[model samples]
Target: MHGHYRETAECPGQTRGESSGGTHLQMHGHYRETAECPGQTRGESSGGTRLQMHGHYRETAECPGQTRGESSGGTRLQIHGHYRETAECPGQTRGEREGRVVDGLTSKYMDTIERLQSVQARLEVKAQTLERESNECRVQTEECQQQLRKCQSELNRQVKQSSCVIQEKVPFNDTKTSDYNSLNVPPHNKRHQLKARDVAGQALGFVQDIVVALLNFHSYTEQRVHIYPLDSSIEPISPLNQKFSQYLHENAAYVRPLEEGLVQLHQSITEDTVTVLETVGKLKDFAEHFTSYTHFLQKILPYQLKSLEEECRAPLCTSSLISKNQELQSGMKRITSVFDKLHRYIILLALPSVRQDAMPQSSSSAVFTQLAACLHSLHDAIKEMSKHYSQKAGLEQQLPTVTQKLCTTNECLLASLGMLTNSTDKIATFFSNNLDFFTSSTGYGPRGGVGVLNPLQAESMLGNKKKASDYMQAIRKPRAESVPYREALLNRRVLTSSTESRQGLTQQVVASQEKIARLEQEKEHWLLETQLGRVRLEKESQRIQDLETQLSSALEGGGGSPASALSLGLGSPALTSLDDGELEERGVEKDAMINTSLVGMLTTTPTNEEVRDEESREQLIKTHYMARVGELTTQLQVSDSKAVNFHAECRALAKRLALAEKSRETLTEEVKLANQNITRLQDELATTKRSYKEQLSMMSDHLCSMNETLSKQREEIDILKLSGKGNSKLLKKGR
Candidate 1:
């Protein structure tokens, strides 16, 4: 070793150097650079730490006092040429594989979130449909309930019709007979169309057709209210048919032929009973028509009056009753009020002869039987009066002028009837108007709620997706501290917040699951409500169908038999016990022992001995009529009870419908809240994964960078060794 390999050391700590042929190497303090043979190059750094390149881009660096067991920024790594082991550090490999696993988990989680969002969208739609259907059902239920109420009112009116017949026309005490078999009549008069046997516990008039209410002709009453009580019986103003009773007492001979021809002139009483009974049923139906109309007024008027008073008191009310100036005697309110009071007072005037003491609630058979007995008594009275009038023989001579007088009085009665019909129509129209006003003033729908969410409900669910994705993907690989080879990057700090974030994510998942279970319960409840409503609707529809059938038969004149019209009148007489007085006498209405089934037999039968005796024949006739009256009275009591129960069922169904709709609305709200929570949880989970992934990615990058730097230094060391060997040979040759 001579001057050719001599050291003019420019390196740190007096390091060795070589410059031979075209190769030169120099080191300065802690920095070194080399140029070896045309294109070869090297670098070195040494201070408190050592950094060196050994061969083919291999590198190593170690701090002072660092040992083989510990890490000191030293790693073995290099890029091989054609085929060799790849440049990879243990830390980077472990970190990169784990990061990939984390990435896969993130992708799976995001997929789950997207799927959950779609499911929530579908649930929202389903909830909306249920809300819509329930609303529609509620609306329909309201309408049906109103219609059913109206129909029920009408049906009740049908049951308690024609109170006037029971209240007056026949005196009850005069018709009463204690002994039916006193004038013993045997079962002897068995004709072709009529039977002689009288069935026990059956009304005489109901079983055997005899002249009944129909045989009593329409009579002109003395009282008249031009607009109001032409056909009605009101107290003090327009008591019905009073003049007819007076006429019968006063001018008995003038109108006697009509009754005598029908009742007395029949070929045989039993043979002609069918014709008489059919006519009586129809006459009863027509009489009941007017009476039911009065009853309708009784029901509707008070309600309308209450409504008028309520309307007058309501906020922003413009009712005519509210204006004192318009409520004079000439006003509509005054007129209607008078009509209302008079209609209610009509019962008081219907019988001026001790009406409270009078037995009123007689059935069809009872009415007919009582009328028959009274007519028989009257027949005897007419004959007795004729005996008195026959003494004064001018009664036959005065017939022509009497006929003219009777005709004039009949014309006046007809005129009053025309006026009564017009007034009744007006009152009905007024009552309907009040009903409309009351319904409008109240927000009267049964189902009440606005629970369904709008279409924009989904807007807040997927909150700021762009911002979320950016946070999730934001990452730069990390770097080690104070390394000279590569630029330092921000080292990921210890994940202190990770534990808290993990716990928070777990809580979110648990909360979402709990909400899901609650959603399940609510959804089941909603579905059950829907099912119940559907079932109730079907039942209501069936009830309406039966009503339609009954109404149609009545309207079509009762299906074509002679008894058809008769049945329509006698069939299913409504007993409106809920509102109107179903029975005129409460004690009489409780006929618990009454048989509904009609036994078609007369109570009394005339023997030859009884028929021959005039007083016995009359007594036998009276007993038959009284027995029939008692039986019919018993039957009327039974009908009134059944009608009361049917109405109660309708009310309960309506309440259930309202309850079902409210439950459905609550379920919809719960589902909406659950969907919101799920979306929030999805966002939170995505955020957590992004934070964890970013931290892990940074750590992998830092380890990879360190490993790569060490590999390059090792490669540099190999190249420097080859240059030193060549220089040593050149130095020897030069020596």
Candidate 2:
């Protein structure tokens, strides 16, 4: 049964044999495997094998006599009862010592076990603490997560609220701001415009009020006044006048002579006022006539009138209509009143002169003079009025022609433009339809369209059209004849004024010419003096140049002396003591004289070139003298300063030498101290070297002791090996 069981357990490829006697059996196979034995199944054998294995996976036979399986590596093995089997095993006493040693080892092992148990207890406590910390950390983590969630939710809420608020407020803010801005902007602009308009309107109203007030004042002041020139060769009534040709012929007053004179004066004022009133009346009639004519023309010819209507409205009719109108005015009434007032003022101012002249000049002459002035003024005013009338007539005659010409020209221009437009359109059509023909040879492809041009053809067409247009345009509108009329009026006024001024200035020029002649004579005197001064300046300049040359040579010479240079007048005795004080005084006096002379010469009105030359010469002379004095003063100052600085430097050098000597003594003491410190450091270095050598000797002794201990350990190891060999031999014998 055993053979059958063994055969069944061992497969064909396994090597198997029976060993020993019937009480013991040994089976071998290629490898380990679970198989059925005599009464055991493969499963039961596997279970029995497992039961035989210890907790450490050490396999021991379940049979009491069976040996345990051995695993071999580098470690030593000890049998249970062969404590003394090793060659180095101790005798009984030595065994006792070894037992004691083992006892110590056991105690050490127990201590290690205790330490391990204590370490395990501590680790368990620590683990409990770590677990608590982990739980707390987990709790903190949960709290942090909760806080993070809350923060996230809060942030989201805040973001959403902010978004909502911003969404709501942004438009509201923008709308409100826009509303505010618009409110401010429109009103501000409107207010500014209103202010400007109000100011302008107020200014216009003020100007109109002033003009109306002036007109009213003149009308009121002139209403009661009347005056006329007296006839000469009549007996004078006023004692103050003392004139044979003048008489007071006032019908209202027959009083004392003074009172009679006053009455005459008052009558004359009244006459002058009456004259002004008549002039104003004529001005008003003229204005009204023009205003009526303009109003009639504007009313009748609402648009432009035809030539027939203009021709039928004769010049006299238009003139009469304008003269009869009420608003065709240039404020002439106000001007006439102002002129009358001016005349009265002049008369009053001339009264004293008139009285004085009466003693010699006859009263008739005085009256004639005044009447002549009045007639002259009246003639000037009448001439101005005639010129204005002629200007108006001329303008009236040319206006229709200008307007007709403008209309005809505009129609012609429109026609020309229409023709040009048609030509352009035809050209454009040609280009668009036959684009290839214009640019077939050019690399630009079809370019006859409006955008593209055959350069020469386009240029020729444009040039021809431009030339024709320019030539046609050159047939200018007939130059407005009113321009010449205005020029003629201006020329007439100028000629009249020139004649009047020429006549008045004729007598006055004689006295003026004599005065000019005397001035010219005085100018000749100054001219002579200036010429002499220029000559002297030239001589002085030559002397200065000579002195400069001599001084330069003296400076260049090897052995020239200052005295020799002075003898040559390069260093004048007069200039030797001239410092800034004297130079400033001289400059001031010279400048004053120059200014006075320059003013006199300028007032004399010298010719342009003469003035230029004199200015250049004066500037050159002043610059030259001033530069010469400045150079001399600078040289003197530089030499004196050098001398002074040299003395100061000498004293400073003496003081510095004493200080340097004291510093050298201090350096000597520092060097001695450094030498002593060096000596102390050298001694300390020697002592340190000695101590290092002693410590090295002690380390060498320790190494020798360690070598002796290693030698003893080697012998003990050899003994152990020999003992191991004996044990192997005993085992072989036993086998």
Which candidate number has the best TM-score? 1
Q: Write the per-residue lDDT of candidate 1 for residues 632-732, one digit (tens) a residue.
A: 87787666666666677667777887887888888888886686456435645665687689988998898899889888888888788888988999999
For each candidate, give its TM-score against the true structure.
0.15, 0.13
Report backbone clashes per prediction. Answer: 33, 16
Q: What is the lDDT of residue 452 in candidate 1?
A: 16
lDDT of 2 at 34: 39
- lDDT per residue as tens, model 2, 1-735: 343333323323222222121112111210123321345676776555444323112211122233222211101232222323433554445457568889999999999999999999999999999999999999999999999999999999999999999998776542234222221111012333343344333333322322333233222212211110111133322222222112122211211222223233333322112111111122232233323333322332211122123323444345443442212132233334334543443343333222322122123244334433443443344334334434443444444433443334333333333332232332233334433322222221111211222222322433444565577678864776565888999999999999999988986898899999999978855665566467546765886797788787876673667666665543556567776599679757754555466522522347553466467656755665588799999999999999999989999998899888888888887886676456435544654676687778777788788888888889899999999999999999999
Alpha-carbon runs more than 4 Å astray in model 1: 1-608, 611-644, 692-700, 703-707, 710-735
Residue 385 Cα positional deviation in candidate 1, in Å, after optimal superposition: 99
Q: Model 2: C-alpha RMSD to truth?
A: 54.9
Tally clashing residue pairs in candidate 2: 16
* Weakest ten-residue segment in model 2 by summed lDDT: 223-232
